[model samples]
Target: MSLITCSKGHQNPEGSRFCTLCGEPLPEHNAFAGGINTGLVEGTRLRDRYMIKYQLGQGGFGRTYLAEDTGRFNELIVLKELMPTGQGTYALQKAEELFQREAAILHKLRHPQIPKFWELFRDRKGLFLVQDYIEGKTYQDLLNNRLDNGQSFSEVEIIELLQQLLPVLSYLHKQGVIHRDISPDNVIRKEQDGLPILIDFGGVKQTAIDVATQLAAEKYGGSGTRLGKSGYAPDEQLRLGSVAPHSDLYALGVTAIVLMTGKPPQELFDAHTMSWVWNRQLNLSSDFNKILQRMLAQRPSERFQSAEEILQQLPAVSTVPETRVQPHLTQRQITSSNNNFIPPSPAPINTSGQGHLLDNSVEVPDEIVGWNWGAFLLPGFWCLTNRVWIGLLSWLDLSVVTLGIPTITISILLGLKGNEWAWKSRKWKSVKAFKRHQRFWAIAAFILWALFLIIIIGVILFAIAIAGFGM
Candidate 1:
């Protein structure tokens, strides 16, 4: 049988519509007959260089195609077209503008985890953007495959994934860009290095919003447009049309939770209480849980202020030395002496009981049950030490909103209650050590308070001297 090579390098029989191995479509034999005059088809070459292999995917705004750059040793690339479906002249114009914007944005971005822009041009077929093709499956596909095998991502794997991906998010944020859509479907794990590459920029959504607003003003004399995936996007991005770096963090948190439990955000979130219920189903370390809670906070202000902050909170997983252990002693018992040690292999989860999935043999500390005086005294320090990033952000937000007037009171309250939250969320060597740490922070808080008072008195006396001179 005659053979054909799919864009993904899968070989299939000639006349086959799809590759048997990867399920990618094969280019039609006569696709290039009409050339640019008949739209993008198999074998059709653009700019006398890129050869269209087959269509990859399509949406309302445009279509993505798998193509080969013939001028560059037939290197695989993705070709994006700005062909708005069923839209009038105005909508088409807006799409073209956004397409240019996406190209510009991609051109300026220089991250290993982001696709590199190759070229942007218009031909008889219409506008097209060429970018490096990522050879990998989307996170959604990975999640689905794992679910099909009755396996879900472990806490450690999720943490590692976050560590690998957050830097990319930080890079984007530093460049003054907000990836408004950060769902599992938009992240691809590269086959070469298993590194997650973020795809699908939603800045075009801004153009869509403009088009919708214009249409609304022409019809009902109003303005508004809805953008973002449900459950993944925060309230501000969905309702108020406001997006920030934290908005992407919220979606990232949702993605992590979904990977952990293999459940959709809609199913995990409880609308009645406005909280996520997935915690009840999964056995996660307190610190990890706290980080996720902050990431998925209802208010953007309560979420991690930046990706770097979340990275600070993530527990470092050390590589355990490979050593044969006596059958009598379990891995937990062997590592009991080392407080920072994490077992190379995680114990299987026991779903038969109400307790955590953690092994019973392991003596993990329980979360604190009551108020934390140290937190009330030094909220910022306590949060920094305990890795409760949301608490720290909350303190900062309160200070800013209150114009620093309520700072002392807020600090006092945080000191009173911070230890409880911190202890519950953090892992320490022992209760005694945790208490000692809190006490140290409390002393620091006292010094901070003293400095604050000194500053206030200095300002007051200076003002008094100025008034006396005026008299």
Candidate 2:
């Protein structure tokens, strides 16, 4: 393997698109792209550097993974493995060239708001494009939080978002970097500052879309419809790859209105007229509506050519926290969920007529509700292991003094109540964990009981042998 150093003095793999250390995009003219293979299980280490944590998801043409970089003091980064639809080596090579071309362009991009593309590497498994791991919940996550009162994004919040992200887009576009894909799913509301960080710059994605589209046309005699891209992408951009800065703006406008309306673009736009009817869904100030309308114009020439154009109209709007000026949307107040303490959900009760302990505060799952072998064999030791303190009562001298009748009764009680008593005594992660813990005790008890039986039999046999020898 060869290494290439960027202007920032960061050494990367020979064909890496950006410096892994500083995310510096090197000057163009150096191009390298490779194919990706799949099915690297969790914890799989690549090049003895990146340890795969787990898969993030499968995308339109690739898989994403959350990995730890051992070489960088275990920094978290995202590994994207591109899975081109084309099968032949030529097709794969073509896909790589296209991926590399877009990636090289994306390498020129650097912004705090956008996720940093680091380096590309190849291990035995496949090629991986490494990038910073953003820690935040995406807008989609916030939007889909329906059970949490189903709050929609308010006008003020949307305005704030535009203010924050429009500058980022301006930076990217100034360098001729257009994020072909902009959706609620791609924008993360960073947990640290609550500022949005843009992920999925659409370099590899655009490459895949190109390859997939080409393959579709070659095989099916016509270019196939892209199912997921339809809602966000404009007709010209989706049907053809003639994308500009306005294309991204169009998608952002759609995303903004979607967040406000809590509806997808497919629903908001009337296909019959081929124009937006989002205004009918919700009311907005004229200034905001006018801006959004210009951004979403059907013709690229009609839409705003630059992100700065959108930013100039939006002055710094003061936002109220936890305020709901609009009944339809809410800007969540800076308060913990505990402050509005809802009553704890009732515990699941055993409905099978099985008695419980601690007034049924703890659930006795049916799977563990049975006679306990460990309790029956060694009540004292089983009590220690299972936390069933009542099982120790079997050792009382009163039980032995009553012709062992009390002891027998206590053992039966221990066996019958073991599961319920243990369920109440301690906290368990799950029913499976409880069963596993009890199983170990059962095995240990059986082993000790067998050893005791063997010792008693040996002593009796030795006593008989001694008497016979004396006789």
What lDDT would each prediction earn against the true structure? Answer: 0.69, 0.71
Candidate 1 regions off by >4 Å? 1-39, 85-90, 205-209, 212-220, 318-471
Query: How many clashes does each candidate structure show, in the order listed?
Result: 9, 1
| Candidate 1: tens digits of C-alpha lDDT, residues 48-111 | 8989999886432355789999889999999876543223555555556766777687789999
- Tens digits of lDDT, candidate 2, 1-471: 966654224477766644454333322221123334434699899988999999886554566889999999999999987666556555566676787777677676778887888776655534568888999988977877732454577776688788779999899888978787788888998876667998887666667656766776877777643322557877887666677899889989999988877777777899899899988877777678799899999889999999999988863333222223223322343244644643222223222222235556344677889988877777877888666777677678454357877667767887888877887666554566678877887898889989999999999999999999999
Name the weakest run of 10 consecutive residues (lDDT summed) in model 1. Answer: 319-328
TM-score against truth, every candidate: 0.59, 0.58
Q: Candidate 1, residue 344: CA error in Å? A: 18
Instruction: Indicate the TM-score of model 2.
Output: 0.58
In terms of lDDT, the best-performing candidate is 2
